[model samples]
Target: MDPAIEAIRTFNRFFTRHVGAIDARFLDTEANLPEARLLFEIARQEPVQANLLQAALGLDRGYLSRMIARFEDRGWIMRDRFEADARTRPIRMTEAGREAFDKIDQRQRAAVAHDLNRLDAVAQDDLVQALTKARLLLDPDAPAEFIIRSARIGEVSQVAARQSILYAASHGWGRELETLEAETTAAFLRRFKPGREECWVADLSGTMAGAVFLTDEGDSLARLRLLHVEPFARRRGIGGALVDECVRFARDRQYDRIILWTHTVLDAARRIYAHHGFECIATEVHHEFGEPVQGETWQLRLTA
Candidate 1:
């Protein structure tokens, strides 16, 4: 079997076991996991149409009909015909159903808390971030929120390592790039200034999705360094957002010009720079990162 397919199957199996999906009872509730999920969905989307529920749950028509009948018989749900359309009916939870759902919700929360409490604070945070990334990967069109904020403690090293890994994977760069990133990151922290220099990290749902650093280069010039977006978080405007924040910060700091060095292979980043009115100032063939590449310097006049 293909490695990717096998990996997915393994994850599915593990998740099912972790959630006690094979158990006769879920969260010690009277209903199994699927039935509990249906109840929760109904509570969440009260007055939801039967067709919408079926589509959302991807349930078989006969199975859903039987489930609805069972709920109605148990006095757990009530269905009402649409006033405008006699053929359509919406399903909603009864008082008893809501009470049952509350129990299930509490149990679910407790179960999750029990699992998370086993790990330390950092490990819990890591698990949440990993799950968020996995969810985003599985649903590309899902809505996402990103925030640009100053880097926190220990984040500089994290950003540097991420940059090294990304460059190596995307451009086949060697350890030279990693060394350069680490040195530059260290310098930024060592000579950090409150107002003149800044490092911004793009956070997406609790994970560090991207980062950029703006540092004083003397002569009223600011240099943008180590701009990178994680591969999983690409195509979400994160790179552009990081660049825009850098430009905004530089302009706010009263810099006359903002500059950055990049390569021809980084077309996306180049486009972002151009979009922000940066112009190519110089280009030269350089042997770095174990390869010969055209290194280009770009600058934007902040005064204009």
Candidate 2:
């Protein structure tokens, strides 16, 4: 075996052991890593449908069922069958299980953060950048040329809905569904007024995975919003492409500057915007959803 691969495997084993996630604690059963992983996955939401987990994790149906059943028996999880679809079942965390999972998760995040914090800030940034570059390089296995075009009325709703779900889950904003629906409807409506706003979508192998919008704010400025890349399509140049398109559009449209707003917790998006020449213009402490988040505004100058 390659030395690097061997070293990585060794480090994974050592790390898991030290974190009490390997031998004597979390993964010590017929359930194994899959069940433990499922517990962590369902911990984020009120309930997770079986199909969602199966698709998200790309797990075998039988394997998922068996692991879920084990957790069910242990009283760590409960599965409820859907009346609309007899074959569909959803699993939710019990109060006891959620408490236990949160405890473990906090420990894990603390451990990871502690080690990262040991490095200087520059070194930490470099590490993340390197990792991101590596993933980007390794991720473009899908050889098909993705189709880039404007989002249609028919598909805009679903895209908006998915984007809302992602944001809501990340921010714990229960009302995001209503807020995002209105925003999506508005953005879609703006598409008809081509001079005011432009929304672009990327379709990869018949699936839409990336989207972005540019809205004219005034004579000198444009607003970049609704930038989203689906999880499965990340690291494949979709996001970078969308950003590049935005920059070019702003320049061509004679906008002097482009401004974007986002939360600080979205580190990857921040990095992407930064790499594309966006500078932090303003930041404010704001509470949204259930979390106290720092909202940042970034600006990019467009020169002729």
Cα RMSD to the true fold for all candidates:
2.1, 19.3
lDDT of 2 by residue, 33-96 (tens): 4556777788865477888888878999898887777677778887675557623656788876
Clashing pairs in 1: none
TM-score for candidate 2: 0.51
- Clash totals for all candidate models: 0, 0
Q: Give candidate 1's whole-model lDDT.
A: 0.88
The ten-residue window of minimal lDDT in model 1 covers 81-90
- Candidate 1 lDDT over 18-88, as tens digits, reads 99898777878777888888898899898887778888899997888887787888789987854565226
Worst 10 residues of 2 by lDDT: 24-33
Judged by lDDT against the true structure, how good is candidate 2? 0.74
Query: Model-by-model lDDT, in order?
Result: 0.88, 0.74
Best by TM-score: 1
Model 2 RMSD, rounded to 1 decimal: 19.3
Error of 2 at 201 (Å): 0.4
